[model samples]
Target: MDLPRDAQHDAVIVGGGHNGLVAAAYLARAGRSVLLLERLPATGGAAVSTRAFTGVDARLSRYSYLVSLLPRKIVDDLGLRFAVRRRGISSYTPHRDTGLLVDARDTARTREQFARLTGSERDFEAWQRFYAMTAHVARRVFPTLTEPLPTRAELERKVADPAAWEALFERPLGETVEAAFADDTVRGVVLTDALIGTFTHAHDPSLRQNRCFLYHVIGGGTGDWDVPIGGMGAFTDALADAARSAGARIVTGAEVTSIATDGRVAEVAYEDAATGRTHTVAARDVLVNASPHALAGLLGAPRPPRPEGAQLKVNMLLRRLPRLRDRAVDPADAFAGTFHVAEGYRQLQTAYEQAAAGRVPDAPPSEIYCHSLTDPSILSPELAATGAHTLTLFGLHAPARLFAADPEGTKRELLAATLAQLDAVLDEPLADCLATDADGRPCLEAKSPLDLEREVGLPGGHIFHRDLSWPYAQAPDAADAADEAGGPGTDVTQATGRWGVGTGCGNVFLCGAGAVRGGGVSGVPGHNAARAVLEKAR
Candidate 1:
């Protein structure tokens, strides 16, 4: 897949991860000559699968693991062949002997469970109200993520209608959830989503941003959280296939050294990994899917500092499924879906405060997922027979600077601390179920925030391309700041923002979680970025 030096392309996409690949597919489909480059030996970035162990095949970043918000339009328009298996998520609090299950397409049953847990007639009623309101907001706002940011006047018109603004963004999600439920259990269950994949504390004022997070889970129309048939990576592979099928050239193992811009357009100067040859590709535009921190450094600039509350990610691989004490539930059902391990709001708050201080929380909040339950194909036959599972522990915030001192040692201590917290809830023998790679040492410590930061080139290893806070919101004004700061192009209002895929700098776009939509497995960024590029061309 080698193109000669001086080969000119309509667009050059840096990074062959899922979002970049998706962008490439859409642009190539539109008759644009697009070139995608990847520094890794293979593409997919975090949405990748590797044989970390001899007999085990699992996805990297497994727990940030599910994909439900991928726009239905992308699936149909791209003729994507991947199948998404629907297995709902569940939450368990071992100490209280309480749990909640989110089933597929049964809002009534879910409400009933809420009523039972809360023992109040208002529980079900509030649940319905909250769902309806959030669903409405998601419908209005989620579309904008794929579309380019609206004009200020247009935005004023959209939000100028008092009812529309209240329904979409003005109302606080945290306060709404709190008012909706009488029992702590029901509130806890709903509020857990606020902190799910993010580093935000559950009680933090910023948690309101997650108001629509759960609503987008409805998949724009499909009603459940869906995982690709083979595994998460299947979606990535399908995207790559789609890009290639559309005549886009993807070169993995090629790292761009610098962007040689002639003050008007950008050219990519890169080193080919296989041949160690230096090559340059001139293009009308360059799309970068690397993290903002990484992109800044690549431009020979100092790393942009992360905001005060930005969090770190710690991913792990476990050998066996977690054991919970609820005898009413079958042991097999435990692995059937995702689980939130935090006990309550107070605990969640404490953990967040600790992480903010650069110390691992004494009881860190974790959202655990066992992918083997939904996608058994991800596991080897031997591992499957033994009831082995691939577990992902997310939302553990460790400081990036601390790791800069002693990467390996600090990472090990962080893992040990997280395991100690897990020991408080699960009954499984931690030692017996711990995963070991081919080396026979614990595999849990392999992927840390530092590794992600180093690999993706984001400053502070901040997974969300831009912090999803006030100044970083994905609006038109936000795009200006991104431009000034050289932030990743994430203008959610723009159609081309998906992968930032296109021809000129402004002509090219970005989407996926890294774009304005921030972070998530949802393909909204890619879908939206594509539409922007195509619409502008037209």
Candidate 2:
């Protein structure tokens, strides 16, 4: 089914995610006829911050929380009003009597903390060297993510540090971490960043962990993962406002079912989610911000390898901060930033091995950070005065296949194990300090990969859409441009590697996480797709 030719839009975007909204705003600002459709009753996709508890006033970043990779250029170019606040304390990993606290701004304190944790000043110096290397790589590679993919050799040459490249870009992250840091605890602290949402082992031969580590460290070149000022909702809402102000039309609950590009004007057919009525629209180009698997399924093509999400997310609002057993550290400081729990290198390896065999890790490695601790804007005045705060825990190594056998049972078991692990490090039982909403229920909910897939449109619940790819393209001998890597889209005049946003169909472009350089809430895919469109029109 095709809409009337007269109704053709200059561009149509499917999926009203942050990426799609960004595309709409840019295209509309550029004076193109733009329209965006979202299946949900509202936009924002997984980037939204909502009050998940039935009666809590705390607005938590439900799924995709934190701002690490969002390019400042996108925010400045779009004139987005969203503000991201940097955390003072970077991270804390508590073990027996003491903990490893990383202070972002206080270098002297950070050194002192490391010296005590490692019981030697040598590890602290090594820590400085490792971060210096990452800082250098972050500076060089962050800018290139938004640009056209450079050849691997080109990027390596630009990075220039062979040791940095080998540790981050080439070798398994585990081997690199082991070689750089001598202390076991320090090694774990450094390695945690490499395995955030990724489910691979540190020594996985696939180098999947290396790609994941690059993205986490290369945040807008500064490598600072800032917290959104008001919740994630405020940030996405600003994007929506910018799009509307630029004259782009956005329709919620308009589920796009099919996209066909066989004819002159590409056709987008959708059923009104609100009214269950079918309709077709015409577009000169369609920017799909949905998952790649979703796009393939929509096009009736053979699906890509099923993407598997490998983390369990639990969002909880606590009445007060949990007590820490470590007397040297204050509870406030410990929870203020990323609080790493059970994330040691050996612990992570054991969990991965367990989960890989189709069993949920007995003691899951996870990290928790209190968003309200950093930005009180997430809570109302009453809630804040009452000492209520929001805690979001991300449990690692809980892969999709583990939940595939028994999703409900597995989620409960995993959440139980995850929290128990957290409780072990705390001075008191975690549940004892939990908050209750107006409904008299605990202000906590856990989402497994299956839950994310069902609710947030993440295919197979994979957050990065799938395993992340390197920022640069392979050499000529490596790129399979003709077929598997990337094919001609129905309307795309020029087809390039998978790194290019161009779909095999000429008129369709993937502006989702599946697009290379697209991970987290970074708007690189949207920005790149728009630039590609504008370039082609010229």
Candidate 3:
């Protein structure tokens, strides 16, 4: 079948992932003729679920891995029905003699428990003050993620206000934690939030930004942490359904081969892989959900420059539940929320160093989640009866640029080593219940973070479109400071400003993790992109 070529729409969104779908939905809702094209047969990109095991459907990125910094108002405004269940995230660190679990719900009780276990009242108090301060800053600044970058006047105001500036952008998370806690265990627990889904070390100055990053997960006022009821895919499915209902046309298995520009605007050339047919669609605008590097390749151009970090991912399927040493934990607790295997702050720093050197750590710092423990509906009847589960292990970082050297073999070894590490940690004999060969690891898939640079067409797979550094956010003279700081390159503020959905680059705008607020599954970039387009149409 030859691909159908419709008349030019108001926008042609490439990559029908969550963000693309979101941008399309907003455009369609605003009465624009919008079309969404995806290379894969299904939408959602990373935020998807697939039937991997026989009779089992599991989220691709399990647990939506704790909500990204998406805005709540957009959810209500779009009438999106991706049901998110709220629960406080818990962190646990177990040693030979002691273990500690930090619960966001009963902070007072949790604090008491911490104080008892670590014998550090000062640490507990510090944690309280830090959380309160960080949460306050997050409340004020995170909302700006959905809007365009701050104007010069607003930026100046924030920079001039000492209290406002420190609360929002200046306080270093590590320094803050060190000042608050004398116990290593308590300090480790507080720092875990900074490392979740990221490769940053606990001691790095960049970790301060992570403090604000945690606030994004708190859901504005919806409380901290939410699990989409049916799994993360439901969130994407709801957005897709909402987009279609709102009159956006979505075509999957339609790989965008190139974005050819006629010097004035861009037209996307795509190949429908299933039919071996090619087609072209003209648009005044385009939104790419792929990583910046991937997008640059499709455009047949030198990728725009990027920052120096990479994004990598790993997924796992387990035949049995993780046997944790913390006997007090309810068996149900394993699946109810995320589990952090952070031994201490130094341990995390070592892992980051190893990754930087292009080596996997022997005892990796990991954040593990067992979806079967949380959502039983996806498990097979037999698996559920036997308490089998699917576990996702994130936080294995390597030089982002290393994937090109030995992608498959390296990933295979990393996955095998990770499982071995898991075996070492578990009290039970996990090796006995192995369902798949060690050589053919199913869940452990790897992708270079630098690849995001290509896919999203951003500078260094440094998504978030720009780096939300303190200097960028708090500079009194944003335009002048950004200009001086960047010299001739794009910095954070300019990146955030260009993220308006339909307003930037002659209809080509941005949405997704690489936009203004960067990566995570929050859907904020998508939502913001949509609003930008809709506002323009109005």
Best by TM-score: 2
Model 2, range 345-443, lDDT digits (tens) per residue?
788888999999989887899988999888998998988999988999998888889888789998999999999989888999998999987889888
Question: Ten residues in a row with the worst lDDT in model 1?
Answer: 495-504
Candidates, ranked, lDDT? 2, 1, 3
TM-score of each: 0.83, 0.96, 0.82
Question: Per-residue alpha-carbon lDDT of model 1 for 1-538, expressed as tens digits?
Answer: 5567678887788888777887789889989999898998888877766555544455554424677667767777777887777776444434346455554457765666555555655876876676665555455555554555555455435434555354334555555656667766566556666654356644445544554344343355433566677776788889898999999999889998887553245678889998988888788766677665555445554555552223335444566665665554454564566565654656766776776776667775555666677777877677677766776666444546556678788777766766666666666656667777776776553456667666654445655555543212334454444443332433322322222322123533444454555466666656656666566556
Point out where model 1 deviates above 4 Å: 1-5, 57-64, 105-124, 151-168, 202-208, 211-223, 262-264, 297-303, 307-322, 397-406, 434-446, 469-508, 535-538
The worst-scoring run of ten residues by lDDT in candidate 3 lies at 484-493
Please tell me which predicted candidate would have the highest lDDT against the true structure: 2
The sequence of per-residue lDDT tens digits that candidate 3 reaches over residues 170-240 is 56666666766777666766666665444566555665345435544345533266655667777788989
Q: What is the C-alpha lDDT of each candidate?
A: 0.60, 0.84, 0.59
**Model 3 spans with C-alpha error above 4 angstroms:** 1-6, 55-64, 152-164, 202-218, 221-223, 262-265, 298-301, 306-314, 317-320, 380-382, 401-404, 433-504
Better of 2 and 3 by TM-score: 2
Q: Each candidate's root-mean-square deviation in Å?
A: 4.6, 2.6, 4.8
